[model samples]
Target: MKIDAHQHFWALARGDYGWLTPELPPLYRDFLPADLAPVLRVNGVEGTVLVQAAPTIAETEFMLGLADDNPFILGVVGWVDFEAPDAIGQITRLATHPKFVGLRPMIQDISDVDWMLSKTHTPIFRAMATSELAFDALVLPKHLPNLQELVRDHPDLSIVIDHAAKPEIAAGQFNEWAANMVSLAQNTSVAVKLSGLVTEAAKDWTVSQLRPYVEHLLDHFGPTRMIWGSDWPVCTLACAYDDWCAATDQILKDLNETDRDAILGGNAARIYRIKGAA
Candidate 1:
């Protein structure tokens, strides 16, 4: 099954996905299952993991409610206040939900890019060890060093690097991004997501413009550590869902079947510990 491991859901009326308004003009409107299903069908995606876009427990509950009705949504990487004094209880509460597969903190929103390396967050991460939950680093390249340090301390934590460190491909800044990417991927516990490259490139970019970034991730992380993600409506900023999928397909056309399968779905299933698909 082809699994798009990174996608999102939001209700504008809920007023939770606020960061999207300024950075994601194309997707400022509500992006429900109704809006995402067609794109999935067009791209032949069989299932997806609904990731968090806001920092609210209600957002997690809301995604759980949606997952109940949508079979395509196989898992959810929802949000919760990890640093709360009662974080252990909160993690226990969230663990009861079958769809709750992981968590995200939106590290890019934090002022201190190195917060992941702090001792304060270690306990919160340790709390997640109760259920062995994976954590997505929603961060930029600047935070990669901190992430590397975090992996050293929490060897069991499955940290996925979202958006390949969000390269500055639109401006052709590949060398720096590549250096950080390689450094982060060196941590065996960490995995990389091959998504959001189109948004990092120029609006009128061709498939070739994104190949270097895609190939770099595959080369550095390899198939076992690389997973596919659609990034959904945010991807609409540079290209539609179908366009991004097509570009990715073209770029990997030369790879062997095993590697292709890994990037498309196998890696995601194994890394997220999702049942059946792995």
Candidate 2:
């Protein structure tokens, strides 16, 4: 089954999306399942992993509500206050829902790079491990070292690096990101998402420009550990939905069918442990 492993839905009326403003006209409007269903059907995408666009627990409830109504959404990756006193309690309560697959702490937005390794939040990570939840790390290259440490320390915690650590492809900045990614791949068993690359590239980016990074990911992580994601409306800023999918298809044309299928959907299902993946 083809799965758009990372996509988001948000309603501006909710007021929880602090970063989404009217200046970004393309994504200012509400994006729900109905808006995405037609394209998914056209592309033969069977399922999706609905991710959080806001940091509030209330938004998590909103996502859960959407999951309740949409069967195509295989799982919901919501957000949580990592340093909050009731963090574990929030995790426990969210884990009760079968669709609540995991939580993302929005590490990229935070000013502190070493926040993920905080001693104060150790128990929260443990609680997540106890609940058997995945950790979607939304971080930049600078945080890769600290991320590597966390991945090594918490082997039980299923950590998936979101957007391949969001490498800066637009500005031709690759050496440091590539070196860090190599380190993570060599040292930790962390899974990296092949999503959000388009957004990180130039506005007029070509598949050729993105191919090198894609190749690096494949070379290091291989197919079984790599997952494809659309990054959806955000990706629209750089490339259309179908164009990104096409670019991915072209990039993976050389890989065998089994390996291609794994990158497209199988790996996501396995990494997130989505129920009824087939």
Candidate 3:
């Protein structure tokens, strides 16, 4: 099965997407399943993991509701108040929904770089571990060290790094990001999504500018721990869906069928526990 492991669905009227405003014309409006289904079809993608674009539980419920109606949505990585006093109860409740496969705290938006490692959040991590839910780290390179610590502390937590830590490819620098990525990959339990790179690079970015980072990830995480994601509407900011799909294909052209399949879909299926994805 071909899966777009990460993508988002949001309604502009929801009033919860703080980062998505008219300022960003491409993604300022609604992007629902109707808008994406054709793109997925044309790209030969069978299913997708709908990730949260808003931090509110309302958005999570909204995505889950959409998933209930959309068979192509294999799973959802929603958000919850991880630091809330009733976080365990919240996680337990969310886990009852079979489609709620993972949780994502927008760590990148949080000012405290060490927020992921706060002692108060440990119980929440434990609850996630107990629920067998994956945690999508929405982080930047600076947050990686703390992320490594979190992975080490919660070895049972299935963690996937979103957007390959959002490398500064546009600035043409990789030493710091690559070093942290290599270090983080030491924990076999952690995986990464090869998504959002096009938006991070120069507007006219070439595959050559991305090849080094992609190769670094392939070398360190290997295909088993790597997953592909379109980042969808956000990706449209830099390029179209088919364009990103073609770029990803070119990036993985050197890999044999087995490995390529894993990065493209298999790894996400295993990590997110997406039903019937194989």
Per lDDT, the best of the predicted structures is 3
Better of 2 and 3 by lDDT: 3
lDDT of 1 by residue, 1-278 (tens): 89999998898999877686656566777889998898888888989999998999889999999999998998899887867888778888888888788989988998977777777888889877668788888888778777777877888787888888898887888887788778877747689898988888888999888888888888888888988998987788788888888888999999999999989998888888787675
What is candidate 2's CA lDDT for residue 225? 91
Off by over 4 Å in 1: 22-25
Ranking by lDDT: 3, 2, 1
Q: Tens digits of per-residue lDDT for model 3 on 192-223?
A: 99999998999999988889999999999989
Model 2 ranges off by over 4 Å:
none
Lowest summed lDDT over 10 consecutive residues: which window, candidate 1? 17-26
RMSD to the hidden true structure, all candidates: 1.5, 0.9, 0.8
Candidate 2 C-alpha error for residue 14, in Å: 0.4
Q: Where in model 3 is the C-alpha error above 4 Å?
A: none
Give TM-scores for every candidate, taking all chains together and pairing residue i with residue i.
0.95, 0.98, 0.98
Ranking by TM-score: 3, 2, 1
User: lDDT at 48 for candidate 3?
Assistant: 95
Q: What are the lDDT figures for the candidates, one per model?
A: 0.85, 0.91, 0.92
